[model samples]
Target: MSKKIREKKSTLFSLLFIAAVILLTLWSLSRAEDPDKLIKDIQNASPVFLVLAVLCVLAFICLQGVVIWLQCRSLKLQESLWRCVLVAFHGYFYCSITPMQSGGPPIQIYDLKKEGIHISVGTLIILMETFLFKVVLVILSLGMLLFGHRLMRRYIWPGLFFFILGTILTCGIVVLIYLSMFHSGLLRRLILWLFRKLEKHHLVRSKKGRVEKLISAMDKYRAAAGYFRNQRKLAVLLLAVTMLQRLAYFSTTYFIYRSFGLYGVSYWTIVLLQAAISICADMLPIPGGVGITEALFQVFFRDIFGTMTIPGLCLSRGITFYAQLLFCGIFSIAARVAFRVDKSRLGFFQTSFIVPEDAP
Candidate 1:
């Protein structure tokens, strides 16, 4: 499909999801006793704490931008800081709208290519970024599961199902990434074998051509992985940076909690819970994990949030999820305007074989 048509579809899908979220939230609020009072309670929340909570969310975005900048510097790519920020926002825009946040990478790579980075390098950068983020999230999830199993059991029931599923999903991705990075040849062989079967059964065309292209792409990706492996210190530093990025997101709950005069709960405890909530929410195939996320918030924090539970959900989801959606929408336009992104350069979605790269 053409880029224009694809963009229209994306816009429509995003609007639909936004509408669903708004309607769901309203429906939820309508069921609450004295919905106006709940709004009033949220409105009465301290502006200072609310602002801090937003800043934390922005920090999370900024840290992602920093990751791109650091990766560019390491690769000697000539992308500017502002462009990196824009790319981060662009990724978030697509991620928030799509199921399981799956629409992020292609547009992100396209944006990087617009900034004059080679597509191959951009792909590797994003792959590493995603890998590191998931690794940290999984580690945090496991740590929380191991240490807080007893406390978590109180909220187990349905949330536990999602939690387990999310962990399994994350672990699956981690394994695939490991294979791609360290055992690319084996990955390439397995993929080729699968493709051959599909072709044999008339499931795909261009069998030989596609297989050759796939092998080429895997080689490029493996080479990129090797580059990072050789830069061991830089790789380690990026891992630590990514961990902080995750923490910044987790800390959003802490600020929101404090905003409501809800205190005495250990921040780390909240962070752990936030990690679990995130793990479960991320696993769901919902746009922004909208309903699931809110439900998880209520289930996990009911004891601490008590009467303020609804308001707390409103604030937390507002700042971290919906607010970022709005931010990405506005900033993405601004970035495109500032960068003068060419219409033709913005390609529509397609899965292609990665070819050999030239210098950026």
Candidate 2:
């Protein structure tokens, strides 16, 4: 296909997906029972807890930036913390809008390119971030499931199927990443086999150039993986930071739980339930997992919040997802504008910052 035709089709698909997300959002809102009571509960919610919830969201965003910034710095790249934060917001904005966050990494790589980071390096950074995030989430979710089995049975029994499926899918992704990084030969052979099978079935045009490009990308990814292999301490530090990042986001629900003035449920219990909800929601191919996340939240927290479930849902989704979407959208736009202005004045040049295969 011609480049212009491909672009047009992509745009059309994005528009349709956005329209679907809007409809889903409306449907989710329609599921809320007793708007009057929801509003009353909101009115009576503690302002302090609400503020803390907002801060937790902010921390989540900023800490992700910290992770990115630290990665860049570790590689001797000169990325400012503020710019990294903008990149983080840019990622969140695209991820929220696209199915299963499929758009986030490409746009984020583009954003990093504008900062003079090479495409391979940006891809490596994103891959590392994703690997750590998934690993942390899976570990935490499994631990919760083991220790909090009773809680899971009581609150999330209905969604057990989804929880299990999500866990398996998440583990599959982690294993794939590990194989791609450490066992590239096997992954390459598997990929080539699949490609040949597809080509034989006439599913894809026999594009030798595409295969060459894929091989080239994999070689670069393996080279980037070497950096982590040598820098074990940095790897550990990033993993620790990732754990804190996940916890910061998970804590939002607990604060929202407190905001409703309901008690008897411990903080860790709420955090674990939120973690479970995320595990179930992450694998769904929905934009921001909008309807599904809200539904899961209502299902899991119904007993805990009792009559205030709807209000808690409103507050939680509003602050975490909708508000986040708005703020990240603005930040991403601002980042784009800044990049353009800088390019106009400085004459932007593409530069490659390849990580050395054997660096100290």
Candidate 3:
């Protein structure tokens, strides 16, 4: 199958995967002996806690978009904060749909391009956003492993090892491949290999017609990365901001737990699990890996959290993921409408080949 065709076909597999996860999670929840207790637990949750969750969630959504916005601006592409937020939300909305959850950014770029953004810049925005997020994940996962060694030994060593090994392997590959992109077809070959694997897995199939498109896009990415490479200071600043943004996200969860009058048992362990879950979800091809993430959270925290764990997990997930999904959608709709997006001028939807600052 053509790469695009294969990639497209993976959507179905992702849907099925998500369905399975949902079923398993529900069954697990049902067996909780006190499934009814969760509702009461939620009812008993502090309103202040809920409010704090929402606010922090909103901040996370904004920072998520802004991290990319800053990267775009660094590249001399400019989109309004409203535009950036819209892009981010619409991406999440799409992510919420498929298991392999990585499709949203490309969709966002496609949409943004229709709004008149340059395709190259849109691609850059998405690439930097993704790259920086991965880097931060590696950093955060490492920190938790180091500081929470005690808990890691008892509750999370297997998962932590899985995550750490995966992180190292993935980062090493990305670094080797991306750097090679500018020098030769080596990086392009790596992309093909990766995509081919996805295709083999029915994630993204091979598309002969798309070879040129994909290669050209990679060239643009290489160019953009080269530009960003020259700006060491900008790179540092962007990294710092993205790091802070992720830290803030974790802290929000921390405060939410705190507000619940709950304490102890390695909240940081939950944090690592969350990081690992998100990474795993990317491979699942389910939009945002919704069902998988929830299930994994329940499973991973089972030992640490006991019976009310699912509810706590759900409550936390509800306030965070669902909240971001909703808020970003509303914000994007309002912003797109207020800004008067001209579809024809922008181009319909397609993957971004560059950062999105040039969109509109």
- Candidate topping TM-score: 1
Candidate 1 TM-score to native: 0.87
Note the residue pairs that clash in candidate 1.
Answer: none
Worst 10 residues of 1 by lDDT: 347-356
Worst 10 residues of 2 by lDDT: 341-350
Scored by lDDT, the top model is 2
TM-score for each predicted model, relative to the true structure: 0.87, 0.84, 0.73
Q: In model 3, where do residues sit more than 4 Å from their true spots?
A: 1-24, 144-148, 158-173, 180-221, 265-273, 279-282, 303-307, 329-360
Question: What shift in Å separates residue 26 of candidate 3 from its native position after superposition?
Answer: 3.1
- Go through the candidates in order and give the C-alpha RMSD of each one to the true structure: 4.8, 4.9, 6.3
Question: For model 2, what is the C-alpha lDDT against the true structure?
Answer: 0.79
TM-score of 3: 0.73
lDDT of 1 at 111: 76
How does candidate 1 score on lDDT?
0.79
lDDT score of residue 211 within candidate 3? 69
- Which scores higher on lDDT, 1 or 3? 1
| lDDT for each residue of candidate 2 in 14-129, tens digit (9 for 90 to 100) | 65776686676656665656667667789999999999999999889888889898888877776778988998898888788777777777877877777766566677788788
